[model samples]
Target: MGNANQRTQLSEHIADILGTRDQPACGTSRLAIRKTIACGSMMMLALNPAQVGAVGLGEVELKSRLGQPLDATVPLTLREGESLPKNCVKPAPQNNSLARLSDLRVTAPARIGPGTYSVRISTTNPLHEPMYELSLMVKCPGATLLVRQYVLMLDLPGMPVE
Candidate 1:
């Protein structure tokens, strides 16, 4: 015999992040087993040569995105030098911000399951070609989903790696 219809207090998102460290890159952080990975992404960040900004999937900004009933968007404490990507508004002065890394999205369709994903990013300007890494957003089976942000750097021709 088994309990067929029982709602349990299975898992929560915030608690998971607090307890979690050294997490592999995953858009959706992991949740306890037997819980549904709550749909909808969390804050989307743009990684480029100069700065990392929160990208909006909808009309509202990523950090400001409203949370769902189950999977709440994690409270993001922004560090210094963080701002919205340049294209969100007029191009600022050269020293003000990083050039826009436009059209940032997953390079390939992700197969539904727990694993790493590949995100592809391209720059709006041609001269400032930058380097990037493949970051992952992992999720536990049957767990809520959220987006994890990353930072990338570029090496210009004459720049020293110091």
Candidate 2:
């Protein structure tokens, strides 16, 4: 982590220009902005990395439903080819059957709120060996209805709620 004072200074500088100056004082708003930005940053980090504990060769790609571009950070194992055929490697069928990619849908509650999120984790590379670890992150800010509602309230004041 960067120095707190340094980050705060940078945040305050940005807030001075972009943040609201009507209700709260600059200093107060600066702190609030910094906290908000920090929280959002943390949320991104938490959902970005999938494999934290295990050592293995695997690559993860995240994509939106619209086929938009998303961030990709391939694990070091993939580059070395050490991960292939074991971490990334699939088992060959005994009777000349082909190795196939499989997809598994894991639904876990969003870190921010209610409603289960459907995350489809697909892999062309197979984890043939036992205990091959891989983690995938979902940094879905508007993934939760509650979060969307909260943001809507901030954006649209006195908006009807049902």
Candidate 3:
């Protein structure tokens, strides 16, 4: 019975991402999953273009715990010259400083391209979410640039990777 429940839970989680669990997938990132071989709530960035002010600048969908749309930002950390796609939109930025006392909701668009792109999502307290000193690395042809870090709390218990 326990095993069955686990399987059911897993299925539900997969279905939730696939949009069979609740609301249909909406927004560019979710919709583009079919176009790109690699697509999901999380993306890994690799390269960044020069003369770019912000990378991964846009809005992303965040479903409520019940699988409904809840405005949320897909926070990003970029290296110098590493920036998000332009025209991205999201909910107004929240002052995460007061996150402990209340739900600080925010949102940003998911970034797409040939560079490594990723957003931090987790449940740990906001203070531990790396609000500062977070930036993506851009592997240029001859040099690597670090874009300014823009932290957004999306996933619970955030996970870090290179």
The number of the candidate with the highest TM-score is 1
What tens-digit string does per-residue lDDT give for candidate 2 at 72-156?
2222221121111112222222221332223433333222212212223433443342222333332322221110000000112
**Would you list the C-alpha lDDT of every candidate in the order shown?**
0.29, 0.34, 0.39
Model 1 quality (TM-score): 0.23
TM-score for each predicted model, relative to the true structure: 0.23, 0.20, 0.21
Instruction: List, residue by residue over 23-124, the lDDT tens digit for candidate 1.
Output: 445523444221233222222222233333332221111211111111112122223444322222121122224433343332332222222112233333
Better of 1 and 2 by lDDT: 2
Candidate no. 2 TM-score: 0.20
User: Per-residue alpha-carbon lDDT of model 3 for 1-162, expressed as tens digits?
Assistant: 999999999998777566445554465456445535454323434332343443432333332222222333344445554545432322233344432312332223344434434343223223333222222233333333333334434344334421
- Best by the lDDT measure: 3
Q: How does residue 129 of candidate 1 score in lDDT? A: 32
Ranked by TM-score from best down, the candidates are: 1, 3, 2
The per-prediction CA RMSD against the true structure, in angstroms, equals 22.2, 23.3, 23.1
Count backbone clashes in candidate 2: 5
